[model samples]
Target: MLLCDTPNLVSSSEVIAGVSDHDALLAELRVDSRRPTPLPAMLPNWRRAPWPKLNDRLAEEMHAVLQINNLNDAWTAWKTTLVGCVSECVPSRKSRPKRRLLPWLDKKLKKMIKIKDELFAKWQVEKTLESRNLFETARRASQGAVRSRLSLPAPRAFPRRKAKRVENHGERRRQLAIHVLDAKSATGPDDVPAVLLKRCAKTLCPSLAHIFNLSLRACDLPTDWKCAAVTPIPKDGEKSDLRNNRPISVTSLVGKLLEKHVRNQLAGFLDTNKALPDNQHGFRERRSCTTMLLRTLDSWTAAIDKNSGGHVHAIFLDWANAFDKVPHQRLLSKLQHHGIDGAALEWLKNFLVGRSQFVRFGGARSEPCVVSSGVVQGSVLGPLLFNVYVSDLPAVVKTNLVQYADDCTIFREVTSQDDVDELQEDLALIDIWCVNNGMQLNAKKCVAMDLSRARQPRLPQYMIGGAVLEYVSTQRLLGVHIARDLRWNHHVDVQRKKAAQTLGFAARNLRGCTQRVKRMAYLTLVKP
Candidate 1:
């Protein structure tokens, strides 16, 4: 969605106009309740072509071309051929099944609703006691039927519960705050269609053929094309606080596809060469954060089983803005040290330097700023690049290191003060490595937990950077929660409650849906 390099400044009046238009459309949808209205259609896919048919056409085009002088030319021709064929032959998907938000409205209910509306209309016009009574009775019957079908408790006037209305009002305020900037920026909902069209054209064209050719080297990237648009999202706290914001980059879809293609090649190369360390499970083939957590848990369980009374000191490292703060120069140096060179090294340098992004809050955009450090936040190459950047940590520190991306944990079997002192030395070595690599440990966020059958008579003081680490009874890694004692009870309980809440929402809204629909919704939303 971050397709535009530059955005025009928008006025508040233009935004208000769009919001008013949107509100009008929503109001129109709510006007009629007696008869079912046709559901709105899903947006068209501008780039979705019939792959089976298009592939044959593309093959014929490729076969007709006898010679390509440059690798860049070949890549450009291939992309052009694909776009020309696809743009002409793109097929439409089948229409989605119509859905009703209030699915419980049947013929009988519809009749009752119609009657209620008629009586209400008459009461409004006549302003008579008899007309009002008729309207009230019809409305009560219609409302009761709805409540009965949805299994909702009867409405009651509870003075104390009136306070809950404040919560609803607060939610409206939050939505308004999030949308105000967007509305004022003159970026309307129609921007998506325009962006998609532009993206399609850009992909089909050969403006960056040279960049695509560099992918053959599988180490480097193209120049200005690699810059990403960064947007800030609040990190689950008070929205007013700037500290709670985290920038997430939204890059070009075409660029992402190229990056993925290059990533696959580099991943294979790294795997075959065994250039990456085994301790690193991030962005590698057949490795994930979950896998890393399971391995760490396995090690913890094994140590506990081997020595019932022995303690394993587990310290989870937190780097402040790990991806955003990566020193580009240091990262490139690390890559070179790991044997990445030639066109690939140059490409990486071009990819990292002179990148500019403007933050977008709703529709309003800030002035363009240069990004001097870090990997692109949402880039496919980011995790792999980070892994390469920190791959030497195991060599730098003599301890059991388990890493999944930037979520690193180092632990050692501890008994006496000597063991604790040695662990502190290992921490210092890691800190030094981080500094050398243009990374800093967030000591405040970093946590230490002692895993043992029995508590040690004395606990060790752990310090990272200049700040001491806090000891926690439990911490969540990946999506799984782990207690100091390594019990699954906390995780199980949390998952169960979440599932119940999801199911409750599904049951309420999906009351009159078909059994098959209900089951599908449950499996898709609640089960996971």
Candidate 2:
């Protein structure tokens, strides 16, 4: 019984220490196999003794008999006596009263009786084993077999490969070669190589020259490049003349204003406190600048009038791996052509070097560690540097192209099919520019649509191939969510009705209260 309850017993040290005393009693009962000779020869009177008190002796005796090593011996002794009891207690139908008299005896009944006898014999054997001195030994051996079968092997581990020293050396050499090439190419304004300028035109302003100025500034070009030394000759009778070769200084009042406005708009997003170094060891300051530039371009585009019949054509360009694939020599030449000078150029060169580090989590006592690529997103100067490199393309193509980061949009005044064809040619040039700068045009995202159709009261929808382009009205941009069937005015009317009902209910309730108050005042006066 104690062995049966052993699983439930909680020990101060371990939960299941050993078997219970009930098991010992069962084992002893099975071991005592001697029986009374016959019923007539039995003692005149037989009485049951009081239960034995539990003590250290009983525990010692049980421990000796139930040793795990002697399990088989104990089990065999218990089974012998158990089998004898089954043979005597179970009845044999062959020796039963005549079945002809009762007429109910059959083979099925005999089979059932035999089955019962067999079951009884098995139970008696189990009970005898349970009462044996080696019961605990038997139980432990059985449990051990089960545990051995269920046990799993410890997992094998593979050794990690050490980073190759030769690989690091090669990478360093490649980086050094790039740096040397960039330095050698960095010369004067005209020194900006044709290839670099062409790339910049493609990347910075494939549609308009105005964006070139922004890209130059974003790139941190030298002071000289910030100003346009040559001015454009105005059209006949236009506001400005072509002969004016005065240098347009970025430090000038208008230039400063533009810079200030762009910075001010970006201030909300530029969190200096959170800025960290990126994987390339550069800070990400350009994201804010890019955002500001895009917003400014959007605003400028929206200001164009549709009623004047001035059609706008825009294309957004996306460069694949813009930062990673930047040709250092080409970029340097572009910077030189733009007028980037000594110290600024040197600082940029140093900024390109990559650095790495490891990171850990959890606490001092129990911590987990992991190795990963260094910070690449939250760096303070990372965005600015990236924007500088990316802006070069738009700057050179600014004659007709408008670029806000990778998003390029070309606008043209279209009247006829000839005009559309001309715009397409210009767009093709823009695509070529992108290809030159290691950028690819994703044709799926690129769209060319007519603003005239878009401006209609109920605009006729257009599709590129089979895919419908979303037509957004200027009015819809002003916080109005437009659906196919629902109009803004209809929503406003519903809101207005709801508001009026709410006001009417309040007024009615107030009127009732006011009348009651007046009546009370009159009653008080009359009572007085």
Error of 1 at 515 (Å): 4.8
lDDT of 1 by residue, 361-466 (tens): 5435678788889887667788888888887789888779998888888998887888898889999999998877778888888999888777653467899888
**If scored against the real structure, what TM-score would every candidate get?**
0.66, 0.29
Q: How much is 326 displaced in model 1, in angstroms?
A: 1.4
Tens digits of per-residue lDDT for model 2 on 410-490? 545455566556655555565666668655555555554344323433223333324433444322211232222223575
Q: Model 2: C-alpha RMSD to truth? A: 38.1
Score candidate 2 by TM-score against the native: 0.29
Model 1 segments more than 4 A misplaced: 1-119, 127-211, 214-224, 455-458, 507-518
